[model samples]
Target: MQINTIYTRSVIQTMAGKAIRDLRSGGERELRNVAELCKGCSASPGYQTFWSLLENILRRPDQQYAALLSRAANDVDINCLKTLIANLGLHAYPNGSQPLPGTRESGTSPSYWMEPLDDIMDPRMLHQQISRLQKQGTSSFLFRAGQKPELETILNIAGKHRQCVFFLICGAESCCRAYLEEMTALGNVIPLMEYETLAPTAASLKQAGILFGLHRRYCEIESLQAEENLLRQCIALGCFLGVYEGSAQCPSQNWELACYSRLQEMRCNGAQEIFLADLWRDREAVQKLLEQRSGQV
Candidate 1:
């Protein structure tokens, strides 16, 4: 169903009003009403808009609404605002004409500053920083090595960027790798994949139209065999490759098995490795495959 912006805004405004009213007085009844309102509101058109508006209202120091705002902000489903509030604190929301101490009227909050890790290398402090960043929608940050001050400076910069993607670039060493692996598992960091040079295969040559004529390029036997094999593997893993388009497309028995048989015979005869990237270029198809793997579809 398609919903216009005006209608969606109206719904959000109505929901926000009801939520605020509930927060002001009614107990269990109000909670139920707010939940109902939330359910009715469409999250499609403007999830962030609704959240920001609600957060701004809740940031007021009024004791009556503070508890409700806190509770709502902490809710797992709508916790995005919690990150903003955590970083901005009380200064995020101002009182009428007067602005909060740490915040400027321009609405730009100051960056968080951190001490040098060399001077105060507390694991607990690193954990806390990582936790705060995760909540703030940051995904990744770069970590340098050798120069202690440079690493410390980068951490401080990263704490404020709120980037949702991070890449750690340090010297390749056992200690660095160990530390990075630990941090990645803890959701504090993401390690970059090691570089590897790939050698071109028969499949790659065929793909470049070198092995087959232009008209028969897509009909390359080895390339087709490799794709079919990968598709079969995906299916065996409970993945659906969606509908296939061809004159010989079968609908009765599982096509995965049929494809696998073709691939196995070709591989036995020395077929080349198929580039994973070449087999899956459609984003929608890739997304569906991921969802299927994760049991989302």
Candidate 2:
């Protein structure tokens, strides 16, 4: 007989035992033993192994099954995978079982992107712009122009509101330096600087304390050299940043923003605004947050 067929028959027998016990009394121990056996059974291949096993033992309704599914989903590192396991049973689950895409499964849902800033070009412009944008019910903004003074001003404004700034750091080193200066001047807006570069590794990124993400086709040696230089500066300045590898086909801007949100949530308590002084001086705060969410088992 096929292994799957034999397993299926064993599952059926276990379910039958559970059902029969439910109709009578004093069979709790027997049901428990059967549940342990099922859990010990190796999970099947593919994404739906746990789901199948859970359905096969539905009569027992083990809490361990739910816990296992959650852990397994996180292990896969695919957001959709978590949703699939959570919504559908472990095997041959039907579609439309999970929550809609773009919604976070764990932490609080992030705020939507606020109005885009056209006039503001630098972090200095953040103060006034953030106030004005807040009045309009916006939380985040992207400034494309590389104006240092303007960026600084904006960062200051956003600092008061605890808002975060996502600065696109493309172009020359001088331009990137100017952007960083403005961020320092604002002393507030949680700075999430995304540079267009090739090298995307944890060690390479740690130097900047700045979040890093790769640009499409940035794997060339020249691009990698520039990125390394930028990362060194980021580390020296004690910036809070991460590395993301981009793609020509997907671009990854939206996905990168999602990662930024996760990081911001780790640092801040969903506050709409943040301050640089608090961010830097709050060593205890940073330690606690990092320790709690080290993402390690």
Candidate 3:
């Protein structure tokens, strides 16, 4: 049943990707229902179009996230916002407990993330990183907890710190069921199913030659009816929900369709604490747009 759910999710994700590729091709033929389909492709549900996504993520915020972060000093405020954080990797801090000292995401200053050690037996680096982030008053931490050791580090850190350690489960391909099971056991380490990486869906679509390939992919899938099962699994396992974001080098269409599908399905399945990676720096605007559109809907 779980395997079938994973396949359906993959196929739906592929459908969205094909839609994005069609829009990006810029041919008039691509406009045949592509624009309409592409509306929810780049951003979350109800974002409506690529323009809507860009306006929210690329443009200035309707409300300042920096101010939001400052005001989110207390535990209540942090909990209200879900204490979201993202992409705090080992490379982010090279010299010391900082993000390589002088880059866009500097280490000397209060950083947005704190990552743990990647090695199975060694979580020392992660501990150091968390300590530094803690000193800077960070309330949240991001970790790629796809593996057992990595998850263990998160649990250890969560036990030691009062902060929220947000776990990004990359994909079912890379993560095992045990990851969620153990994470649920912890009861505090946040379990998050990742979104925002639309490349795989797009690739499947491209390879499947758009709709033609999608149909073929569907034939390979076990069932489509099981799409929402994973969300229920995550929710039942105590997942808080999380997503990734693309860079300026990446396109909005790359993520829209698949994420939109997941977001809608997640909502239908009762996911309430969804969060965007890169923290809210890139997500707040789109989230506001989604809220506004949902209201109108």
Q: Pick by TM-score: which candidate is best?
A: 3
Which lDDT tens digits does candidate 2 get at residues 1-297? 235533543454454344334323424454445345444442323223433443444344432332222222222223222222221121221121111122245664422233446565445454566665444323345444355555445545544553233434343331354444443343232233444322333233322222332222223224434534554454333333333333446544564445434434422331211111122223333233222222221
Model 3, 67-86: lDDT tens digits are: 22222221111221222211
How do the predictions measure up, each by TM-score?
0.21, 0.28, 0.35
Task: Write the candidate numbers in order of decreasing TM-score.
Answer: 3, 2, 1
lDDT per model, in order?
0.32, 0.36, 0.36
Which of the two, 2 or 3, has more TM-score?
3
- Candidate 1 vs candidate 2: the lDDT winner is 2
Ranking by lDDT: 3, 2, 1
Q: Per-residue lDDT tens digits of candidate 1, residues 1-297?
A: 124423443444444544655655745556445544553432222323434444444333432233323233332122222222222221111110112122235596522221112333354565577556444322333343345444444444444444232333333231243343333232222222211101112122212211110111122334555655544443222221122221234333345345434534433332322111212122233333222222311
Could you report the Cα RMSD, in angstroms, for every candidate shown? Answer: 21.4, 20.7, 18.9
Q: Stretches of candidate 3 above 4 Å error?
A: 1-110, 113-121, 170-185, 194-244, 251-297
Weakest 10 consecutive residues of candidate 2 by summed lDDT:
92-101
Best by lDDT: 3
